[model samples]
Target: MHGLAKNHLKKILSTCSANRDCEYYPCHYNNQSCLWCYCPFYPCEDEVLGEFVKRKDGTLIWSCMKCNWIHKPDIAAEILREITELTLDKTTECSIDYLENRELLMQIKNKIEKKLGKSNAI
Candidate 1:
């Protein structure tokens, strides 16, 4: 895996050590965890998982504060596995633009679905 990807995977695998410090520590949801404090695949084209929010400065941001799909250990692990196989040579940006990488996103989604044994993306 590339250095950036590998580092991301490591962070996902590590459970949140500061969960207790957060006001909303444990969300009442199955498999929910704080592993994905910052989603690598932020602004993913999963409308069901997130929506665009306009901040006071008029900057559009993908808000997924209520989404916990990536927090599941199994899902995170599966995503990391797929990420390890990617040849991300075109970009070095921390956040991936869904429209710009539809093919890669589809592949990762397929792998994730297969890993979870379900077609539901999430």
Candidate 2:
């Protein structure tokens, strides 16, 4: 391939590259890792959902990028609904000190979206 063509290909590869957030040996950052290639949850490519996540029970759930239509393992999610129904008798103060992880999540979503667009899946 010509030098300019090679450079252009590299730009495309950056967004298409697969990465492993898990601490696995010999990650495929170079050319081996097969990360999230497409919207894994939604069935139809036209309505590609954002991604799939594993619940504490190891069940998979697909969440919409635009909406909150989480699906899959309907039975598993029922536990969550039940939990929400129950409440403590007494009021108690609670807080969550979580750092902003939106950027990281967005980066992964944008990369996946860009790759899907390149393949003309939309």
TM-score of each: 0.53, 0.19
Tens digits of per-residue lDDT for model 1, 1-122: 89999997666444643255456666525435566667666667566666888999999888876566776667766776666556354354533443247677776766686668432243
Off by over 4 Å in 1: 1-24, 27-31, 85-106, 114-122
The 10 consecutive residues of candidate 2 with the worst lDDT sum are 90-99
Candidate 2 C-alpha lDDT tens digits along 1-122: 99999998776454333333335412322333232233322332234434576789999766444322222223113322332333233233321111123443344335444543322212
Each model's lDDT comes to 0.62, 0.36
Total backbone collisions for each predicted model: 0, 1
* Model 2 alpha-carbon drift over 4 Å, by segment: 19-122
Instruction: Give the number of the best model, judged by TM-score.
Output: 1
Error of 2 at 116 (Å): 13
